[model samples]
Target: METIIVENIYKYYPAATKKERNKALNGISFTVKNGEIFGLIGPDGAGKTSLFHILTTLLLADGGRATVDGFDVVKDYKQIRKRVGYMPGRFSLYQDLTVEENLQFFATAFETTVEKNLDLIHEIYIQLEPFKKRRAGKLSGGMKQKLALCCALIHKPSVLFLDEPTTGVDPVSRKEFWQMLKSLQLQGITTIVSTPYMDEANLCDRIGLLQNGSLLGIDTPENLTRNFGKPLFALKAEQMYPLLLHMRAYDQTATCYGFGDYHHITFIDPHIQQADIRSYLQGVGFTEPVEIRQIAPGIEDCFMDLLNH
Candidate 1:
């Protein structure tokens, strides 16, 4: 069942000059299935947050339509709000309130009680129990994240929207947060999450790559990488930046971008081999050893490829 449907959504913001409007979302469209974890993967200002606001009914789109849990985002916003739980990118909980108080506050606002939906947030709330008395402002980043999530789920919402829930969180906390999302799936809650981290894309059932207010592509992580239709190679040298510049200037180079410890390059000619690149680099000023090897494309590689095209 489709829990969410967004069709040709468009949004615009007034530009600084006031003579032009900046398009925040450009005919974006996608769907989310019941009990599915859908990820909006993109960098900052890529329309992820704007699209989230539209779906959550916090902001209206300039054009097009969207429905959450079969309720129209515009006309039926009240119904949608009741059925969905939203955690904005930033921590919006009361800083002066303790963890317990925040949770109770959200529950009461939803016309529900923490005890009434204890089972819904029990797994997550347990982690925050020790800090129940701690003021939200005094808690750690991870603890604050947990508290926010607990409050969002305290009302037993059928659909959850999390906007960059782990942006400033620690690595350990990020891993734990994804695990908690998986747990929510087992309870039959549909989740829509947005994140700038490419690594987290693999954790979702499927992802939509958005850039410059446009959707680059949408598919499973494995399929996105597998469909990258070019031979890719990772190259490393003693001088990384110089190697990158040299590689980009190479005649056979199709796409060359710096990855973590190495630069990933694709060739215009599929027949080109690693030895050929190594030989070319050696013939140039790169007298030192150059490590070049064929490597599998990852989600970031796929996203970059889409952006380039």
Candidate 2:
């Protein structure tokens, strides 16, 4: 069963202040399978947050329709809200409230008690028990994040919406958060999480890549990577920026972009031989041309390829 079915969803914002309001989400559509963790992966300003808002019923779409657990977002919003838990990108918990108080407050809103929902949040709440009496604002970033997740799960919702939950947290905390979400999947809760991290796309059962309010592709991480028809390589030199520009200007160099420690390069003419790249770099006066080899296309590589297409 699909926990969520989004069909041609679109939303546009009006101009505010001097800036023109952007098309936050174009006619984007995707399905999140029941009991699975689905990722909406993209960079900042890619409309991941806007889509989350619409699906969670926090905002209505200007076009299309979406349903959460068989309930239409607009027509059955109350029912969907009761069955879905949302954790926004920012930490919006009550700063003055103790960890336990914050948890209780949210649970009460859904007409439940922390004690009654103990089993539902136990996997995450247990991590927060030691500092249950501590103020939410005073807790460490990791701890505060866990508490916020527990509160979202307090009502034992059928589906969970996490909008960039690990954006600013430490790496260890990010790993822990994903583990927690995976654990909840065993309890039959569907999770729809949006992330700016390309690396995290592989963690989900399926991922939808978005850019500039449009969906570029959606597939299981394995399948998406497998379908990348172009061969990729990481090439770098002392003068990186100029080298990239030079490569892009070449007819054989199909695509080039910064990839963390190195720049990723893809060739359009597959038979164009590596010697051609060497000659091109040397011809451009590139000093100490670093290693270049055929590499597997990562999510980031595929994303760049999509943008180029």
Candidate 3:
């Protein structure tokens, strides 16, 4: 079953003058399947949050239509709110309230109680139990994250919308959070998570790569990377900074960017060999420790490829 459906949606923010309005969403269309974890992947200002607000019925689209669990987003907002959970990009909880207080407040607002939904949030709730009495404002970033998620799920929502849920969270907390989403999927909850981190895109069943309020592509991470249709390589050398500059300056270098410990590159001339890149680096006075070998394209690589051309 399709839990969410969006078609030709468009949204714009009016500027000082009518001629220069900021277009936040342009011809956006996609669907989320029941029990599927779909990811909207892109950098900031890619329309992820805008699209989220429209689907959740907090904002109206200038054009087109959407439905949540088969209800019209515009006319059935009240019903949608009752059945869906939303965690905005920013922490909007009552800072002065204790963690437990915040959870209870949200449950009450949903016409439910935390105790009634404990089974749905047991794993995350247990982690926040120790900090139950702590003021939400005083909790660490990770703790605040957990408390917010617990409150969002207090009503046992059928669909959850998480906007950058892992932002500003520790590595361990981020990993735990994704695992929690996976568990929710097992219970037949549909999840739509948006993140700017390319690495996180791989965790979703499928991802939509958005840029400048437009979707570049949508597919499974493995399939997208495999279909990039290019020979990619990772190059590392003694003077990493200088190596980067020289490699980018190389005539045949199509794309070059620093990625973790190595500089990843793609070739403009498909016929170019690995040995040719090695010799070029050597001639440019690079140290002997220089290494260049073929590597598989990652999501980030594919994103850059899409953005570049």
Candidate 4:
């Protein structure tokens, strides 16, 4: 079953001079299935946050319509709020309140108690229990994130929306948090998470790649990477910086970008031989043992390919 449906959603922010409005979201559309973890993957200012606010009914879209669990975002906002849980990009809990107090408050707001929904958040709650008396503002970054997540889930919501949940947290905490989400999925709760990290795209059941308030593509990570229909190679030399410039200047290079330790390149002519590239690099003053080999496209590669086209 489709748990959430967004159709041609559009949102705009007025500028001071009124010459041009900031198009936060432009005709964006996608659907989330029940019991699935759907991801909106993009960099900052890509309209991921704006789209989240619209679906959560915190902000209204100027055009188009969205329904969460069959309740329209505008007409049935009250019903949607009751059924869905939202964790904004910012930590929004009462900072002065203790960890336990914050959780209790959110539970009360939902007309429920912590104990009533304890089973729903046991894995996460146990981590926060030791710091139950600690003021939310005094907790560490990872702790604050866990506490926020606990509060959002205290209501046993059927659908959950998490916006940039791991943006500033430590890597270990990010891994743990995603594990918690995976556990939540087993309970049949649909989740929608927006993230700027390209690596996290593979964690979701499916992802929508958004850029400049537009969706570039939507599909499973494996399929999206597979669709990047070009022979890709990774090259590296003793002088990494100089190799990048040389690769870009090459006649056969289609796309060349620095990726970690290696410079990833795609050939404009697929029939070009690797031996030819080696010879070219050697002629360009690169010594022997210059590394160049075929490599598969990753999620970032696919995203860049989409952006380039």
- Supply candidate 3's per-residue lDDT for 56: 92
Off by over 4 Å in 4: none
Q: Poorest 10 consecutive residues of model 1 by lDDT?
A: 282-291
C-alpha positional error of residue 209 in candidate 3 after TM-score superposition, expressed in Å: 0.8
Best by the TM-score measure: 4
Per-residue lDDT of model 1, residues 1-309, tens digit only: 999999999999999897888999999999999999999999999999999898888899999999999999999999988898999998999999999899889999999999999998899888889989999999999988988999888888899999999997778989999999999999999999999999999999999999999999999999999999888999898899999999999999999999999999999999897788888888787877888888999999999999998
Number of colliding residue pairs in model 1: 0
Evaluate model 2: give its TM-score: 0.93
lDDT of 2 by residue, 1-309 (tens): 888999999999885765776689989988989898999989898998889899888999999999999999999999999998999998999999999899989999999999998998887887889998999999998998898889889999999999999997777888888899888998998999999888889899999999999999999998898999867788767777787788888778777788877888877777766788888877876757557777898887787788877
Better candidate by lDDT, 2 or 4 = 4
lDDT of each: 0.93, 0.88, 0.91, 0.93
Clashing pairs in 1: none
**Relative to the unseen true structure, what is the C-alpha lDDT of residue 111 in candidate 2, on a scale of 0 to 100?**
97
lDDT of 4 by residue, 237-288 (tens): 8788989998899998999999999999999898778899999888888775
For model 1 the TM-score comes to 0.97
Query: What lDDT does model 1 reach?
Result: 0.93
True-vs-predicted CA distance for residue 2, candidate 3, Å = 0.8
**Please, what are the lDDT tens digits per residue for candidate 3 over residues 1-309?**
899999999999876787788888889999988889999998888999999999999999999999999999999999999999999999999999999899999999999988999999999888889889989999999888888888888998889999999987777888988998888889888999999888899999989999988999889899999989989989887788999999999999999999999999988887788889888878988756778788899999999999997
